[model samples]
Target: MRSGIHPETRPVVFRDRAADTLFLIRSTAAASKTIVWEDGVTYPLIDVEISSAGHPFCTGTARVVDTAGRIERFQRRYGRPATHRG
Candidate 1:
């Protein structure tokens, strides 16, 4: 560990807006907001769009993409170049 070279780390509250969940973890991220935790302690609050709580993969609600269909659509749009046969 080097002094004066690393960002200060503190317990910060990350609020997942999508899932409406809160997570308390130590990080070096900056935040201008504050929030009181369940322990009645105030910490820096950072609002996040998504987290493990709301992610499709973590919740096992992920959908399988149709790559074949996408390829067909792309080919139909731009089309493939013709190759010359000698």
Candidate 2:
């Protein structure tokens, strides 16, 4: 709560190129470019490569790897048999 000791937190826009999405949130992130939002107001625009919109985790596209299944799939595709040695 001290004055002049913390970076200013202001409204900024984050753009996800992968998802082609734009989010308006308050952040201390610095921006070298600006863009006019839908409200006809200009805000700092930060370009991001990934975000929830484009992330597999959020989009339910992530695969849960099963070791046994993975080995079988790999063997089938590559024709390298999986060896189990005890």
Candidate 3:
């Protein structure tokens, strides 16, 4: 480790506005806002559009794509026969 070369890493809060979720973690990122955590301590608050809190995979609400319909549309437009498999 070198001295005076590494970015400052400390506890920071990542806030997801849409989900209203907050996460406390160590990061070198900077923010202009601050918030008091549950422990009565203030930390830099970084506002993010999405995080694991609201992500489809993490929230278990992922959307399914209409693959069959898309394939049919593609075949019709390109004049290709639809290949069927067992």
lDDT of candidate 2 at residue 24, scale 0 to 100: 97
On residues 50-77, what C-alpha lDDT tens digit does candidate 2 reach at each position?
9999999999999887999988988788
lDDT ranking, high to low: 1, 2, 3
RMSD of 3: 5.6
Query: In lDDT terms, how accurate is model 1?
Result: 0.97
1 versus 3: better lDDT goes to: 1
Score residue 45 of candidate 2 by CA lDDT: 98
lDDT, candidate 3, 11-83, per-residue tens: 9999998899999999999899999999999999999999999999889999899999999999888889768
Better of 1 and 2 by lDDT: 1
Summed backbone clashes in each candidate are: 0, 0, 0
Off by over 4 Å in 1: 69-86
**What is residue 9's positional error in candidate 2, in angstroms?**
0.7
Report the C-alpha displacement of residue 22, candidate 3, in angstroms: 0.7
